[model samples]
Target: MSKEKESVLEGFKAFLMRGNVIDLAVAVVIGAAFTNVVTSVVKGVINPVVGAFGTQDLNMYSSCLKAPCETNDAGEVVKGIPIMWGTVLSAVLTFLITAAVVYFLMVLPMAKYLARRARQQAAKEEVQEVMEVSELEVLKEIRDALVAQRGSGRNDPGRNGPGQSTP
Candidate 1:
């Protein structure tokens, strides 16, 4: 049981030391911070600008029924239920804007850079492989030459027929 526990601990230690795991942790923290900034931008700058051209505030949109929608006053049932579509519109707009910014600013450039790096790496690997094959061919030729030279030598007397009388 002790041995098993030690092995598990060793394995966990190796996992924690891996570069990819550390990089992923860093990326998550950065992404969380970036999200806060984007959210503030949506709520503060974009929402107000959109509200200026519209009849409703971005935050006030909701669906209400059975009573006066505003919490301040109670009105008769004759007035139809109020459904706030402005809030939904604001949310949809924010999502679109965020997605566009992330795609154009981060995702696209990262993808292009990665593709270029991969191409460069592949070219390097191909060159190394060709060099290795050429070296192997040279070694094979040397081996073949040695074998041919040995075969050309005269046979020794000791290598004659096995049934011959001993000296």
Candidate 2:
């Protein structure tokens, strides 16, 4: 039982040490840190700009269905359903900011780089294809010249290839 437990622990340790597991852990940590940065930016920058249009604190925005939403005597809600629109709006703005930042800072540049690399590869292949076609054309011309020389009657002295003469 002790040996079995030891082996199990070692197996678990090995599993945790794998590259994928480590990479995933790093990604999760970085993602958390990035989230905090984005959240700070939203709170610091966007909230103020959006606040110009309305309340700076979106959490304060709400509507009560009943006229008497609260009772001052009890200091609590007496009768009414409060719709918290501010919370929803805050979440929507945060999402939009995150999406825009990721798209502009990461996705757009990566896409452009991949597109340019693909175009360069295609140009190289096109040039290689043209060179291959040119080589084939030259080969065909050489073959035609050889056939013409042979058919023109080898008895002629001038038509023989260099280093060869009609004997």
Which prediction has the highest TM-score against the true structure?
Answer: 2
CA lDDT, every prediction?
A: 0.78, 0.84
Whole-model lDDT, candidate 1?
A: 0.78
Taking all chains together, each candidate's TM-score versus the true structure is 0.58, 0.70
Local accuracy of candidate 1 as per-residue lDDT tens digits, 7-113: 99999999999998999999899878877877788888877787787633676655676565545355433454877677777778767877898899999999999
Poorly placed runs, candidate 1 (over 4 Å): 55-57, 65-70, 73-87, 122-167
RMSD of 1: 7.0
Predicted candidate 2 versus true structure: per-residue lDDT over 13-117, tens digit per residue:
999989999999997997788788888987898788878988778876788877647745854666887777888988888888778988898899999999999
User: Would you list the clashing residue pairs of candidate 1?
Assistant: 62-84
Compared with the true structure, model 2 gives a TM-score of 0.70
Clash tally for model 2: 0
Angstrom error of the Cα, residue 154, model 1: value is 18
